[model samples]
Target: MPTGLRASDAPTLQRLCGSDQRLFLRIGQLLQAKLAFTEPALGEIVGNEALKKLALDKRMREVDATSFATLLAEHGGDGDLVLVDGEGEAGWRVIAVVDELGNPLLAPAPAEVGGAAILATLSPALRAPVEGLLHAGGDEQRAAALEQLRYAAPPLSVVSELMPMLLADGAELVRERAINLLVAAGAQIAVIDLVRALQRGDLAQLGRIADAVSNLA
Candidate 1:
């Protein structure tokens, strides 16, 4: 016997679901079951008509408070509700609102793994939450991440920082992928340094540099 959702809980749940589709499917399943059984507590939290209206109103407004308020009077607030000007507001809009924080949040995407404490340090973890993606996953995901790296205009110093991981990767495929990414990213100086490291008896670091130089020839 399943329960139904209450009036208050629906809006928040709906908002969360709408924000992320995959999450929505998971929560939607639970909500559906609760709705079927008339679950009092679940219903109370998930079925709020007022909240639902607010969520809908928020959506209709989109991310622009002024335009949103003009169309709908429910979301009128004069404070910092509207993000305008400056780096903080811009960061919030890009990271929190659009979820595209990789560039704006982190100076260089890979440096995000071991850089400062802000969003950059959290970028790698955020992008690849699963251990499989971060640690020793298959070629597919690593290749994908490497491809993304090619498009990023990170500093050469950052590329130098990441060279060791690429050079020491256990998988040949990962090494190859890293070489391709570095080359695509125009890290010629870093490539030369990696080649020099290989010449200095760093056998462990030869794989990626070797592959990259071979491609150059």
Candidate 2:
């Protein structure tokens, strides 16, 4: 499969990588190679014992294996480097997969879907639960609802409905979950919320926000 990006993506990607020429080049090479990997293949490569029992695997053929391994080792711990969740720009999930052997894969996600669009794609059985818990629920219920939506909706789809509001949720537990979900989703609101807090002279979260933004970037 072809990587979703076009030539025009170079500039944008370079900026995203902070103009690191080498990093940009490595990312570009991986995109051009258009690699796809299965979980078992990656598991064997990464030394995951349970996953290493697979019969066959996809091996590296194009990209530099060493560099790819370094990339995975550096940014692979958290899902941020590979998966752009609901809160990011509505486009492909940039660098969506890394085989841990030598290559990466980029895949498209829904361009931009709202809560309704997300719900429309769900099975009939899931619709009511998702709908009921979407806007109304206690702290725990809201958290579970968000988790349910993860499977039914694209990363960017829920941002409009859940951001900022969830950030300021009355329950500390709910607010914490919202923070984790939004940050994982790559939501800009997370950063904006942090900046706002900083502006209000809240220094306690400064380091945390910086780390979150760094990962998001």
**Candidate number achieving the greatest TM-score relative to the actual structure:** 2
Best candidate per lDDT, number?
2
Candidate 2, pairs of clashing residues: 86-155, 86-156
lDDT tens per residue, model 2, 53-120:
11111232232334434444543333222322222333222233433223343333444233454566
lDDT digits (tens) for residues 1-217 of candidate 1: 1112221222333343333333323333322222111222222323444423433342432334345334334543222122221243121111012122223542444444532323344346333322233454666776666656655544445554565445444455666666665565566653454434432334345444433433432
The count of residue-pair clashes in candidate 2 stands at: 2
TM-score of each: 0.29, 0.32
Residue 71: error of model 1 in Å?
81
After superposition on all CA atoms, how large is the RMSD of candidate 1?
Answer: 21.0
Q: What is candidate 1's CA lDDT for residue 118? A: 34
